[model samples]
Target: MLAFREFVRAAYPLLSPGASITLPCKSGGGGMRPWLMLILRGRTRQFVNEGAIMDTIERAGFEVACMDEVASWADVGAVAREVDACDVLVGAHGSGLTNMVFLRAGAVVVQVIPWGKMEPYGEGFSGALAAHMGLRHVMYSIAAEESTMYNRYGEDHPVITDPDVFYRNGSNAKFYWREQNIWLNTTRFAPTLQMVKRMRRE
Candidate 1:
């Protein structure tokens, strides 16, 4: 924890004392939380239809905000605050989910994973992170047809069968990360967004 704070301090030395990102405390001018934040990862894992995703999230009744690990200038303090304000944190299976350590209780962390057996990762690492942080975990598994990998290596490649070995090699992992992108089927993704929206806020 000390190491993480030090990293955050180094990365964002400019944070104001009260700096924070917040979802509106009321929705539709009513007494209920008006806006919820759905943070999309646009950095390491590229989403083919980013606008479509934002639209889907908005249509599901959430007010969406996006942060890219590579692109955004948002500092760790801001991100931690966003996680505190956020209802759902959306991203592919990656280290971005590690930021959930700042998430508030009952919030959701949605991990969108690839076709190659990246399970337990969502259920293992991110889920455990959420559990430890008092946050909820959701998964968005990319189907074979939805994954670009299906077209590149066919279904029988070791990339599909023995991801353990394939990923163990740095070059292979780089190639896989560079080439594999998920084409999300928004129709299938909306329900989960709605579920997050309706989840009782902490």
Candidate 2:
């Protein structure tokens, strides 16, 4: 997720009206799932209670689109051209479509990695491939500092609490970060499609 954070940071400076922010997803939910649940369930109001990460980004005054929401995933080749035209690309989890589009277009991509939940995307291969391809290292999306977890069992008590203590109660589980590197920041052009292909073959 460090890679994603750096990407965001780098892109943040470049972001302006009409900038493209490509968000990749497996269906709809990605690493932003947990936060979504919290907002929907009235557990938290962070990010302005946005329904999804894409929504939040859109509210930030940037042009955002989801690859999964497009006509078809197979059409990524054509879609990549569109992604390339964007100012920046933001992807979550294994990077899925974002990696493919960015690599093909030789555009900047920011990938998010979850801490606690490891979604392997063949870092070695992608890193090497992107490097050879000249993808830029941007930002990362690691665990946030001062992040707190909460329990569902505590109705009368605070719904949100520290993850450490909440886990002890055997209730809800949440992840919190304080400037941590659970996520990796990377910049590689032409990500290793072979690794992604290999994983799919598995």
Candidate 3:
């Protein structure tokens, strides 16, 4: 596997890094607030209800900011500097999660897990990456109703009802990764934000 540092240095060159995002809540309720950097996906897969995510974060008592650079192979140093400023880096399972390397030590990496492929790509992979970098890792498993797949395939489709059946092969696995986007069930996901807020204190 390519080293995390090496992968970050060579991300796409077209997209420009967005304005530095910062978290506003620190500790459970003290010290400088911790910032959450939500890496927005520019292409197909996306956080369809981003406002809800920000609202949930604020409600969880952490300052949060969204950014547009994760898809771009932009300036690595600039991205690193901005990531270092944040206390948490949150993104869905995708290349953008690679930004975990830039996080400050003890900062949290919160992965919004995608469907079917949740185990390896979503939580397991990055949890290992976070540990390798001395960072904390958390996962928000998207509920079936929250996934676009639920609507497209309807609740009965194998992918929606039995993801294990859907992910039996590599081609189907790719479909899960490429076609699925999340309409986060913020009510359920809020606890995850609260979890990250608690992690910020330590």
Worst 10 residues of 1 by lDDT: 25-34
lDDT of 2 at 184: 19
Best by lDDT: 3
- Over 84-159, each residue of candidate 3 has an lDDT whose tens digit, in order, gives 6777888887788887776656788988887665767665578887887778888877888888988988988878
Q: Give Cα-based local distance difference scores for all models.
A: 0.63, 0.34, 0.71
Rank all candidate structures by their TM-score, best first, as comma-separated numbers: 3, 1, 2
Error of 1 at 165 (Å): 8.7
TM-score of every candidate relative to the true structure: 0.70, 0.39, 0.80
lDDT of 2 by residue, 95-129 (tens): 34234323322344444433322223434434444
Which regions of candidate 2 fall more than 4 Å away from where they truly are? 1-52, 55-61, 69-72, 95-106, 117-125, 144-202
Runs of candidate 1 exceeding 4 Å displacement:
1-44, 71-74, 153-178
Global Cα lDDT for candidate 1: 0.63
